[model samples]
Every structure is written in structure tokens, then in C-alpha cells.
Target chain A: MTHLKTKHRLLADKAMLWIVCLFATLTAVPLFAILGEVLLRGYDQLSWSFFTETTPTAYKAMKAIEAGEPIPGGIANGIIGTMIMLGMAAIVAVPTGILCGAFLAENPKNRFSQTVSYLTDLLQGTPSVIIGIVTYMWVVVPMKGYSAIAGSVALFVMMLPLIIRSTEETLKILPASLKEAGLALGGNRARVMLKVQLPAAFGGIFTGVLLAISRVIGETAPLMFTALGCSFIRFSIDKPISAVPLLIWEFFNDPNLQELIWGASLFLLLFVLTLNLTAKYLAKKWNQ
Target chain B: MESVKPILEFNKTCVSYTKQTMAVKYVSAAIDRNTITAIMGPSGCGKSTLLRAANLMHELYPNIRVDGEILLNGENILSMEPVDVRRRIGMVFQRPAPFPTMSITDNVLAGYALNGIRLSKAEREETVERCLKSVALWDEVKDVLNKKGTFLSGGQQQRLCIARALAMKPDVLLMDEPTSALDPIATAHIEKLMQELQKEVTILIVTHNMGQAMRISSKSMFMYLGELVEYGDTATMFSTPKDERTKAYLTGRMG
Candidate 1:
């Protein structure tokens, strides 16, 4: 009886192992398929003109694409526009987010911190489209036109919660002994935060920044309401701009421009993928 | 001995994290200058709490109130700014706490930087050498001064912490079972270092090792459950404990 029971257990365990492996492969298939398709199909369009030229808004470009001719233009304008908006948003968000995080970490017991933490949590749960619409009303309406600056405000709003939460968590997770050591050495509160806690949490904080950037980099809903996607190249913050995701959204329906959309999708995916991987790697190396 | 001034004095000090439960009860003791005083007790007996009260290090927690007087050089430290008070009386905790983010040389100079005192590169180097040598860690770490402080062994890291505290030029040093996490050999190394350190600054050490207290301290104080049970010269306390409770404790009847 014991030998027969043991045999039955072994069979069950083997069945469970194989079932898990099958599910694992199932979960991985779509990710690999998407990557494979993008890399193979997108490689041909990543040429010099593909990068340095602007998109043609004309419907005839779709005819050229349908005729199996090379698309006439590239997404340099989208790439540059994305850079401008992200850079602007980073300039405003990085310092503000870190400082806010520090305040939360340092004065954990204060009533104001409690209120701020609750507000930050609420803001994080709020939808991305709502933020984009709010930014459009606040900045675009005031300026009487769509602009990259308004678009960046939307991105900044989306990024705040991630940055603040990550920075706070990074600081909170450090050993109390580190801060106590600084205090014992006669460091003031600010000095302890800057020289000890901040440095100790550097890797976590930088990783958080990268994660925040990645989260917002490919968001098209916010940009649609603010920057509103222009065809021409424009660097001015006050002018409407193009971005990879926005371009993909606008041209995905056009048969002639479908290739550009695929190419842009690939760029967007790889860009965010590289950032997330780098952030994860740095978090491991530094937090060690 | 009578002519020597007390470097630190606790006048009926009381410390508590919350209003309801006290960590350190009404306890008073005087620690003389240029001498090593050991506070020995069982776990959670308030020895560490009493030692931390001297420098207002207890302020690290919010809502914990400290009432009564803590005097340093005849001035009440309780009334002074906590930061400035800490600068005058440094502390070393049970475990080696060399800043993980700093290098050996930088760790030693951290005190000066914490105080916002800018020293020239030459002066900073000189101070680092002097402090590390004082703790006898200079030769072992001189070649790797730029390496991270965490790269050192447990004993070396603890010694580096001592050097870091000493660099601040504090008038008194408080150690709370600093060798509890160390091996016997490392503990002996620190005990010997404390003997030399006492010649320059008043030392107050909290330890659970009764032999360690008897070995290095000229004066010893025994505390139990938020109160001081006995205080006297180490030899008299160990050889002829007057209090019945002290005798019972020494004999390991109860903690």
C-alpha cells in the first residue's frame, strides 16, 4: 500500500511540474512574438532618412505605401519632440519629487505629511487621461494653443507619484544604524539627509527616476490632449509637437503610413525596454 | 581623585518613549574626566538608555521625553541644542556602523563634515591619520584608505567607527556594548584601545559582560529594570557587593 501511494504522489508531482512549465511558456510567447516581429519588420526602416526626415500628412503617401514603395519620410521630428517634452518634464519633476520624498521620510509623524501622503496616493490612482485633460485646460487653454510644454505638464503629473513613492521607499528601507551613525557624529538633520541617507539611497532613487521616465515615455493619451501631434518638426516649447506614440496613434489607420507606425512602435518599445532593464540592473548594483 | 571634575552627570534623569512606559527611571550618576566608567546590566535594564541620555541622543525618536538634568562640563545639556550637544559628547553603538556609503578616510572625517567645519585637504588628511592611528587601525587600513568602509572586517569597521567619533574631538565618548557583536579577540582589542582612549577623553561604556566591566573600568554602575541598583569602584563592587540584589545578580540567581 505504501509503495502504491508513493507512486501516485510522484505522478502528481510530475504532472504539476509539466503543467507549470507549459503555462510559463504560454505567458512568454506573446512577449517574444512581439519583439521578434518588431525587430525583423522595423530593421529596414531605421535608415538615415528614416531618422532625419518629417512625415508627409498627404493621403497619397498611403498610396505610395500601398504600392510597396519606401515611405518618403522618417520620425526625427517625433524623436526630437519626445526628447524636448521629457527633458522639460524631468527638469521640473526630479528636484520637486525628491525633495517631497525627503520631507515625507523625515517628518513621518507630522500631520501635514499624513495629508500630503494621502493626496499623493490619490493623485497616483487618478486616470492618465484626466491628468492630460487637466493640463490641457490649465496650460493649453491659457496659452490659447497646444504646446509641448502643456504636454510635459501632463507627463510630469503622471510621473510625480512614482518618483515620490520610490524615493520615499528607498530612504525608508535603509538601515536605521546609518542615520544614527551620522547623528552621533554631530550631523544636523539636513546633513544626515544629504550626506548619509541620500547617498545610501542613491541607487534606489535613480532607479525610481528611470522607472518613472519609462512609464511616461510611451503614454499617448496625455500627449493627444496637450501637444496634439504636429506633422512638422518644431522644437519650441510653446509649439505643438510630435512623439513616437502619438505618431503611431495618428497614422496607424493610414494604409500608406502603416510602415512608419510599425517602425515608430518598435522604437518606442525598445526605448522603454532599455530604460527599464537599465533601471533594474542599477537597482541591483547600487542597492547591494 | 576628589580634585578631578566630573565630565558628565545625570541628575535624577528620566527617559521614556511614551508617557506611559519609562525606559530609564530616576537615575543619577557622575562620570569623572579622563576615566573609563562601565555600566553593566542585563538586557532591557536601561543601561544603554541612560548612556544615550547624556548626549541627548534619545531625541532620535519623536514623542520620547527626557526630564531632569544632563550636565556636561557643569552645563546642563538638556537645555542646549541637541545637535551641538551631540557634537560635544559622541556615541558608539553595539554594532559596527561605518557609513556604507563612505570610504575609510572619509568615514574618519565625517564628524568634521557633519559639523559643517571645512578643513583644508592637508589638515583633513592629518586629522584622519591621527584619529586612525589613535584607534590602531592606521596601518591596517592606510593602503586602502579610499576603499569603502564596509570592505573592512567587523573589528576593523568598529575601530573605524571609534576613529570617526574621536575625530570630532568630543569631550566624552559613550559606548553601548560596542563589542557585543564582536569575537572575543576583537572585544579584547577594543578593551585595550579603550584603556588608551581614556587618557584623552572621559569614557562611559554600557556592557552586559560583567568581566569586561571589571576588566577595564575604574568605576562600575549596575542597573536593573529602569533603576540603578549599585554604583561604586569596580573592585569593591565585584569583590564585595553590598546590596543583596547585586549579590544575587552576580551569582546569576536572576537577571
Candidate 2:
């Protein structure tokens, strides 16, 4: 009887494990579906022209649709614009964000630090569109125009909280002895933080920077209000620019150019995937 | 008879946490140069706090108040820059902590690197070799200078930490349970190194092991419940302690 009872319990455990496995499979099913659809629908859109040509105006795209011809345009400028905007964001945010993070980590118990920490979290929770609106009032109103710089300002606000929180968390998780050891060696607080503490937490900091970039790279709501979309190759930082996500958003609803949306979507997905993988690889490599 | 000035001195030194009573009560003591002084006590007896006060290592945390004077080389060390004090009086913790990101040679030179002091390639090489040799790790690590410090065994890592401290050429070295984490053989090696190191640098060690104190220390301090109970020459103090608490701690009768 005891042996039979044991067997029954093992059966229950096995059944529960299968249920968990089923849930896991369910979680992955949608991801595979999305990947499959993008690959199948978007592969036909890929060409030298698709990558290098500028986007056509919405009016021109509509005319092409009415004539039963495919839209003759690409996301080349959108890609470039996205790169430039995100590049400016990184440059503006990384140093300031990392410094804020160091301050939070160094003084975890101070009242002023606590206030700053709460404010950072509040900023993170604020919507990207809200950031766009704020940037518009601040930069667009002052400069009296939509500019790539304004788009970057919106994204820079987004990047700060991510970098700061990750850096603070990474530094916090380090053993207290590491800092003590450095201090005991007669190194000043500034030197210890820069040379010892920062290098030790580089893996996590790198992950944070990548995460911040990926998070803001795909943002379209903010870009719509600030960058306001460009139809041509935008070379000046003072002018408006279009990004891949915005291009996809504008073109996907048009029946003739749905494939272009998928193509841009695939490009953005690939870019994000590359960033995440690079982040993981670097974190693991530095950890070793 | 001429009296030699003690290398380090504590005058009515008291320490307390933010919410608690004193961790190290008003304690006064002196440590002579060219000798190993051992501090012995039971757990939570404030021995570690007293040891940390030597180089102001206790200042790392917030809301811990310290009152009174800690003098090094006849000057009040509390008045000096904290880094300068720490640089002059190097410290080793209870557990070995070699910076994981640094190579063995880099770990040895970390003090110099972190202090923004540049050394020539030959000087750096010579310093690393000399410090490692002093800690008896030169033969073991001579071939692996580029490898991470954590790649070594626990004992070897501890020695590497000591070498890192020694590379700074500090006037005094304070160790808190330096060998408590190692095996008996490793412990013996550390004891030997401390004995050899004292000829040039003053040494102060905190230990829980009574036998170790008996073996290596020329002077001993006994602490209990945040108070310095007794301090004197090791040989005389073991046989005839002035305080009852010290006698009880030394005897098998009580901790």
C-alpha cells in the first residue's frame, strides 16, 4: 500500500511538471508567431534599394497605390535618423546617468539621495509621450521648430533612469569588503570609486547602457512630436528626422506598402536582438 | 634608561553605532614598533573595532561616532587625511579579498595605481616581485602574473592581499583575523610572515585563537564587552593577568 501511495505522489509531481512545461511553451508560441510572420512577409522587401533609398512622401505613396504599383521608397533615412538620434541620446545620458548612479550607490542612506532616487523612479514611470510633450514645450517652443536635438532630449530623459537604477543596483550588490580593501590600500574615495568600484561593476553598467539604448531606440511616440518625421535624408541635427518605427507606423495601414512596414519591423527587431545579445555576452565575458 | 616612543597610541578611544551602546568603550593602549601585538577576545568583545580604529578603517560606515585620539608616530592620526592615515597604516581583513577584476601583479600594484602614483615598468615589476617574495608567494605565482587574483587558492589569495598591502610600504600593518579563514598549515605560514614582517613594519593582529597569540605575539591585549580588560607583555600576562576577566578568558574555565 505504501509503495502504491509513493507511486501516486510521483505521478502528481510529473503531471504538475508537464503543466509547467505547457505554460512555458505557451509563452514562447507568440514570439515564434511574430518572428515567423515578419520573416515570411518581410524577406521579399529586402534589396539594395530597400536599404539605401529614401522614403517617399505619403502623397506619393498613395498615388503609387492608386496606380496599382508598389511604393518606390526605403527606410534608409529612417535608419540613419534613428542611429543619429539614439547616438545623441547616449552621449547626453551615459555620463550624467552613470554619475547619478554612483552618487546614489555611494550614499544609499542619506535623505537627499533618497529624494533623488524617488524622483528618478517617478521620471522612469512617466510615459514616453509625456516626455515628448514636455520636450516640445521646452525645446520646440524655445527653438520654434521640431529638431532631431529635441527628439534626442526626449530619449535622453528615458535613458537616465535605466542607467542610474542599473548602476546603483550593480554597485550595491558588490561585497562591502571590495570597497574597504581599496580604502585600506590608502586610495582616496574618488580614486577608489573610479578605479576600483566602477571597473568591478562594468559588466552590469554595460548591460544598463545597452538596455537604455534599446528601450529608447524604438520609441516613435516621442519622435512623432519632436522629430516630426522627415521625408528626405536629414543631415543637420537642427532639422526633423524620421525613424524606422515611425516609418512602419505610417506605412503599415496603407494596403500597398504593408511589406515595407514588415521590412522595417524586421530591421528594428534584428537591431534590438543584436544589442541584447551583445549586452549579455559582454556581461558574461567581464564576469569571467 | 631611555624610553622608546610607541609607534601607535590610543587615548580614551570610544566607538558606538547609531542606535546601540558603545561597541568599543573608552580604551587606551600603545603599540611599539618592530613587534607583533595580538588582540584576543571572545566574539562581539570589541576586539575587531579596536583593531579597525588603528587606521580609521571604522570610518567606512555612517552614523558610527568615534571619540578620542588615535596617534601614529606621535601625531594624532585622526587629524590627518583619512587616505593618508590609511596609506601609512595598511590593513588586512578577516577574509581574503583579492580584487577579482585585477591580475595577480595588478592586485599587488593596486595601492600605487589607485593613488595615482605612476611607476616605471621596471619599478612596477620589481615592486610586485619584492612584495610577493616577502609574502612567500613569489615562487608559486612567478609564472602567473597576468592571471586573475581569484584564480589562486584561498591561502594564496590571502597572501596576495598581504603582498598588495606590503607593496605600499606602509609604516604599520593592522590585520584582523588574517588567518582565521585558512587551514592550520596556511595559518602557520601567515604567522611566520607576520613574525618576519615585524622587523621593518610594526604589526598589530586581532585573533580569536589563544594558542596563536601565545605563539607569535610579544604583547597581548584582552578585551571583553567593549572594554579593554588587560594589556601587558604576553609571557607575564598569560601566567599572571592583572584583570579577572583576562584570567577567565585565558583559562579553560570561561570564554
Candidate 3:
């Protein structure tokens, strides 16, 4: 009977190991498959001119893809517009988020701070699509046209809650001993937050900002309403703007514009991928 | 020894963290300038609280209420600006709480940076060297001045914290269990450093280690249950404690 029990136990262990291996494979296979498909399908469209040339009009989509042929239009205008909108979003979101986070974490009982935290939670839970629609109605429609400025407002709203939540959590995790040490060293409250608390939490806050940027860079729904797609290059925030997502949307709908759609999709994918990698690198470096 | 004014005087100081609990009650003591005064007690006996109150460090807690005057160099530190008061009386915590983000050299010079006091490059270097030497850490850490302060051993980190405190050149140094976190060898190093440091700065240390209190302290005060049980020369207190509680504590009959 004892020998029979030992054999059964060994079989059970083997079964468990098989299940674990199966789970690991299930988790990894799809990611690799998607990455492989993207690389294979997107390789032909990758070129220096893809980044430098403007988006081609409907007439230019008739041209065939040939090796070493400059893609008639580039993504330069979209790239510049994305940079400007994301930059403005960062400028608007970072300070407001950090200050709100600090206040909520440090003085949770203050009425204003409590209200701010409640609003942040509400904003975080609200749908991004709804935010985009609201921006269209309130900002873009009021101004009588789609513009980069309206898109930036939408991105800023999306970025704020992410930064605030991450910064607050980081501050909360900081050891109380650090604050006590600073105060014991004759540092006043503001001085302690500025010099000690902020520095100690710097890595986490930076990662938060990067993650927010990555979240908004490929956002389509929000920019769709705020910055309507344009075939020609335009840098003015007051005018309709072009971005990789909107370009992909417009190009993908036209069956003849397959190569252009794939090229724009590749650019957008690469941009998002680079941002994610940067976020990962920064998080690792700061965590240490 | 030449006579000097007392560096710190706590007059009928009472501290309570809660309405129902008193941490320290009616404690009065005078600490001599340029001498090591050790406050020894069992756990939760309020020795650390008294040390914190001396420098107004207790003010950080909203729930703590402190009554009575804490005179530092003939001024009531309790009434003075807490920032200014703390500038003259630097504190070292029970644990080695060196700023982890700072290098060993920067940790020593942290006070100046946090206070926005700019010193010339030469002056800054000199201060770092002097403070490190004062804490007997110069030789061990000279080669790794740029290394993170948290990389040091527990005792070494504590010494680095002491050096950081001394860099401000404060008139008084308050230590709360400065060696408790360390091993015996590190404890010995810190005890030795404290003995030498007392000659230049007024030292007030709180320790639960009775042997440490007896070895390095010149004047010792015994506290129990938030009251001063005895205050006398270290020799007299350990050899011939007057109070029954003091004798009981020294003989290990009571905590």
C-alpha cells in the first residue's frame, strides 16, 4: 500500500508540472505571435522618409510601393503635432497632479484636499471617450474647429489622474523615518517636502509621468474629435491637426491605401513601443 | 574643569501623547556644557521623549503636548523658533537614518544643502573632512566618499549620521539609542567616538543599555514610568543608587 501511495504522489507532481508549463506557454504565445506579425507586415513600410514626408492626399495613395522609392508623403507634421500636444499635456498635468497628490497624502483631512482627491478618483473612473466628447463640445466646437489645443486638453485630463494616483501611492510608501530625519535636522515642512520627500519619491513620480505619456500618445478616440485628420502638414494649434492614429483611421478605411495605412500603423506602434521601453528602463533605474 | 553655563535645562517638563497617557511627567534636569550626560531607562520609560523634547523635536507630533521650559544656552528653546532651535541642537535617531539618496560626503554635508546655506567648494570639503574625522569615520570611508551612505554597516551608518549632525557645528548633540542597532564591535566604536566627541560638544544620549550608560556617561539620570527616579554622577548612581526604584533597576530586579 505504501509503495502504491508513493507512485501516486509522483504522478500527481508530474501532472502539476505539466499544468504549470501549459499555463506559461499560454501566457507567452500570443504576445510573441502578435509581435512577429507586426514586424513581418510592417517591415516593408519602414524607411527614413516615412518619418520625414508629409501625409499623402487621396491622389497619392494610387502609387505602388517600390524599393528605395521615397514614400510620397511623410509623418513629419503628425510627429511634430504629437510632440507639441503631449508636451503641453505634460506641462499642464505634472505640477497640478504632484501638488494635489502631495496635499492629499500629507493632509488628508483638509476639506479642499479631500474634495480634490474625490474629484481625482471620479476623473480616473470616468471613460476617456466621454472626456474626448466633452472636450469636443466644450473646447473644439466652441472654438468653431478641431485644433491641437483641444486635443491637448483631452490628453491633459487623461494624464492627470494617472500621475496623481502614482505620486500619492509613492509618497504614502515612503518611510516615515525620512520625514522625521529631515524635521529633526531643522527642516521646516515645505523644506522637508521639497528637499527630502520629493527627492526620495523622484524616481516613482518620473515613472508615473512617463506612463501617463505612453497612455496618451496612441490615444485615438480623444484626438479623433479634437484634432481632425489632415492630409497636409500643419503645425498651428489653432488649425486642424494630423497625427498617426487619425491618419491610420482614415487610410485603413480606403482599401487602396493599404500600404499607407500599414506604414502609419507601424509608426504609431514603434512610437508607443519606444515610450513603453523608456518607462520600463526608468522604473527599473529609479527603483534601485 | 572650568565652569561653563549649562547648555540645556529642562524645567518641570511634562509630555503627553494622549489625554489618557503621559509619556514624560514633571521632569527637570540640567545638562552641563562639554560633558556627556546619559539618560538611562527601560523600554517605554520616556528617556527618548525627554531627549526629543530638549530640542523641540517632539513638536512634530500633533498629538503631543509639552509644558515647561527647555532652555538651550540660556534661552527657552520651547518658545524659540523650532527651526532655529534645532539648528543649534542637532539630533541623531535610534536607527541609522542616513539619507539613502545621498553619498557619504553629501550625507555629512546634508544640513547645509537642506538649509540652502551655500559654502565655497573649499569650505564644503573642509567641513566634510572635519566632521568625518570627528566621528572617527574618516579613515574607513575616505576612499568611498562618493559611495551611497546606506551602503555602510549599521555602526558605520550611525557614525555617518553623527558626522552629518556635527557638520552643522551645533552647540548640543542629542543621541537617542545611537548604538542600539549595531553589533558589539560597532557599539564599541560609537561609544569611543561619543566619549571623544563630548570634549567639543555637549552630549546628551538616551540608552537602554545599562553597561553603555555606565561606561561612557559622566552624569547619568535614571527614569521609570515617566518620572525621574535618580540623577547623580554615573559612579554614584550605579554603585550607590539612593532611590529604591533606581537600585531595583540597576540590580535587574525591576525594569
Candidate 4:
């Protein structure tokens, strides 16, 4: 009876292992499918002009289709606008988020800090669409028009909690001896944080910032409410701006420009993929 | 002959984590200058707590309360700013923690940097060489001064931590089980270093190793259950412990 039971348990263990492996493979199926589909559909449209030229107008796209020629322009306007907005949002969020995280880590038990920590969680959970609408009311209306500034404000709001959480967690996990050693050397709290704690946490915080940028890069709802999408490449922050995701949405809505959607999507997907992979690589390197 | 004043004194020093529990009971001791004193006890006996009180480390926690007087050069440190007190009293913890982000040379000068004291390029080099040499880590690390401190071996890292503390020229160096995490060979190296160090600064070391206390310290204090059980010369304490508890702990009968 005991021999029979042992054999049965071994069989169950093998079955469990197989089940886990099968589920793991199942989980990766959608990611590979998306990458494959986007690559297949988007490869032809990707060209030198696709990166340098502004989006072709609906009339122009229709004319190109009628003549059996490819679209004349690319998503240069969206690329530039995304870069500008992301840069602006990062400039504000990185420092503010790190400082807030440091405060939370240093005073884990303080009533005010506890409340701020709770608020950070709430802010992180707030939907991107809601943030877009809120930014629209707060920034776009006050400026009397949709602008890149408003779109960046929405992205900034989305990025802050992510950066703050990462910084706080990174700082917290550091051996208490490091901070104590700094303090024992007669350094004040602020100096210790700047000289020791923040430098030590650079990797985690940088990874967090990259992840935040990737997360907001494809946000169309927020941009729709704020930047509102522009056709021509423009540098002005106070004007309606285009983004890669915004261009893809525009392509989806317009029948004549439908062929351009996959190319724009592939660009956005590739950008996000690169950022995520770099962040992961850096995080692993930092651990070592 | 005129008697020299003690460099540090704890007059009824008490550390309480909460109202209900006192980690270190009112424990008073006087430390002579330029001598190594070891605080020895079993785990949870408050030897480490009493040493932490002298450095005002208890101040970092909101719930921890340190009462009575810790006098440095006859001034009450409890009333002084933590920064001012810590500068004069250096500390080394159980683990060898060299700042992972900083180079070995930078780690030596971290005290000055953290205090916002700018050093000339010449002065920076001199200080780093002087501190590392004092800890006997200069020759091994001089070629790789620009390398991160974490690149060093465990024993080297502990010595680097000591060098970092010594860079500030503190009057009293508090080492809380500094070699507890090190191997036997590394522990011996640090113990020897402490003997040479006592000529420059008063050393207060907390150790669980009775053999180490006898080997390095001129004076010894044995604490148990948050109270000082005995205080005397290391030789006398090891050979002729007065308190029943100290005798029990020294004999490995009580922990």
C-alpha cells in the first residue's frame, strides 16, 4: 500500500509541474501574437520619410490610394510631441517624486506621512481617463485651448506615484546601517539622504522613471483631452500636439488613412519595449 | 599626582523603547581617555542598547526615549544637537557597511562630505591616505582607491568603515559588535587594530565574545537584563567576576 502511495504522489508532482509550464506558456501567447501581428503589418510602411515627414492629410491619403501609391508623409509630428511632453513631465516628476519618497521612507510612522502615502496609492489607482479629464479642466480651459503643457501635466500626474513608490521602497530596503553610519559621521538628515541614500537608490529610481514613461507613452485618452492631436510637426508647447498613440487613433477613425495605423503602433510598441527591456537590464545590473 | 578627567561619563543613562519596557536601565559608567573599554553581555541583555545611548542613536527612533546624562568633555550630550554629539563620537555597527555607491577614497572622506566641509584636492588625498593607513588598509587598497568600497573583501570593508569613522577624528569610537559578522581571522585583525587605535581615541566596544574582551579591552563592563552587573579591569573581571550573574555568564551557565 505504501509503495503504491509513493508512486501516486510522484505522478501528481509531475502532473503539477506540467500544468504550471503549460499555463506559463499560455500567459506569453498574447504578447508574442501582438508583436508578430504588428511587425507583419507595419514593416512595409516604415521608411526614412515615415520618421521625418508630418502626417498626410485625409485628402492626400485618399489621392495616394486612388493613384495606387503609398502615403506621402509619416508621424514625425507625433514623435516630436511625445518626446517634448515626456521630457517636460519627467523634468517635474523625478525630483518631486524622489523627495516625497524619501520623506515617506524616513518617517514611516508619522501621521502626516502615512496620510501622504495613502494618497499616493489613491493617485496611482486613479484612471488615466479621469486624469486626462481633470487636466483638461485644470490646464486646457485656463489656457483657453488644448496644449502640450496640459498633456504633460496629465502624464506627470501618472508618473509621480510610480517614481515615489519605487524610491521609497528602494530606500527602505537599504540596510539601516548605511544611514546610521552616515549619521554617526555627523551628517544631518538631508545631507545623508542626498549624499548616501539617493545615490545608492539611483538604479531603482531610474528604472521606475523609465517604466512610468513607457506606461504613459501610449495613453491616447489623456492626450485627446489635452493635446487634442495636431497634423503638422510643431514645437510650440501652447499648441495642440500630436503623439504616436494619438496618430494611431486618428488612423483608426479615418478610412483613407487606415494603412498608417500599424506603422504608428509598431513605433509606439517598439519604443515601450525598448524602455521596459532597458529598465529590466539596468535593475538586474544594479542588483549585482 | 593630579588625576586626569574622564573623557566620557554615563550618569544614570537609561533607554526605554516604550513606557512599559526599558531596554537599558539607569546604567552609569566613567570612561578614561585613550583606553579601550568593552561592554559584554548575552543577547538581549542591553549591552548594545547602552552603547547606542552614548552615541544618541536612540534619537533616530520616535518611540525610544533616552534619559539621564551622557557627558562628553563634562558637557551633557542629551541636551546638545545630535549632529554635534555624533561628530565627536564615532560608531561602527556589527556588519561591514562600506557605502556601495562611493569609491574607497570617497568612502574615507564621506564624513567631511556629509558635513559639507569642502577639502582641497591635496587635503582630500592626504586625509584618505592617513585614515586608510591608520586602519592598515592603505597598501592593499591604494592602487584601487577609485574602485567602489563594496569591491573590497569583508574584513577590508569593515576596516574601511572604521577608517571612515576615524576620518572625523572623534573623541570616542563606539563599536557595537564590529567583528561579530567577520570570520575568526578577520575578527583577530580588527581586535589588533583596536589596540593600536586606543592611543588616539577612547574605544567603547560591545561584544558577545568574552575572549575578545579579555584580549583587547583594558577595562570591561558586563550588563544583564538592562542593568550593569559588573565593571572592572578586564583581567580582574575575567579572573574574579564579583556578581553572581557575571560569573554565570562568564562561565556559560547563564545567557
Off by over 4 Å in 2: A1-19, A57-72, A253-255, B1-3, B239-244, B251-255
Candidate 4 residue runs with Cα over 4 Å from true position: B1-3
TM-score of chain B of each: 0.97, 0.97, 0.97, 0.98
- What is the per-residue lDDT of model 4 for residues A163-218, given as tens digits with 9 covering 90 to 100? 99999999998889999999999999999999999999899889988998999899
Give residue B153's error in model 2 in angstroms: 2.5
Residues B138-209 of candidate 2: C-alpha lDDT, one tens digit per residue: 999999999999999889999999999999999889999999999999999999998999987898999999
lDDT of 4 by residue, B1-255 (tens): 212799999999989988999888889999999999999998998989889888888889988999889899899999999999999999999998899999999999999999999999999999999999999999999999999999998999999999999999999999999999999999999999999999898999999899999999999999989998899899999999999999999999998
Report how far off residue B250 is in candidate 3 (Å): 3.0
Q: Which candidate is the best by TM-score?
A: 4
For every model in order, the fraction of real contacts preserved is: 0.80, 0.80, 0.55, 0.95
**Candidate 4 RMSD computed on C-alpha atoms after optimal superposition onto the true structure:** 1.2
Chain A TM-scores, all candidates?
0.92, 0.94, 0.90, 0.98
Instruction: Give the lowest summed-lDDT range of ten residues in model 4 chain B.
Output: B1-10
What residue pairs clash in candidate 2, if any at all?
none
Of candidate 1 chain A, the 10-residue stretch with the lowest lDDT total is A56-65
Clashing pairs in 1: A62-A256
Superposed on all Cα atoms, model 2 deviates from the true structure by an RMSD in Å of: 2.6
How big is the positional error of residue A39 in model 4, measured in Å on the Cα after superposition?
1.8
True-vs-predicted CA distance for residue B216, candidate 3, Å: 0.8
Model number with the top lDDT: 4
Sort by DockQ, best first: 4, 1, 2, 3
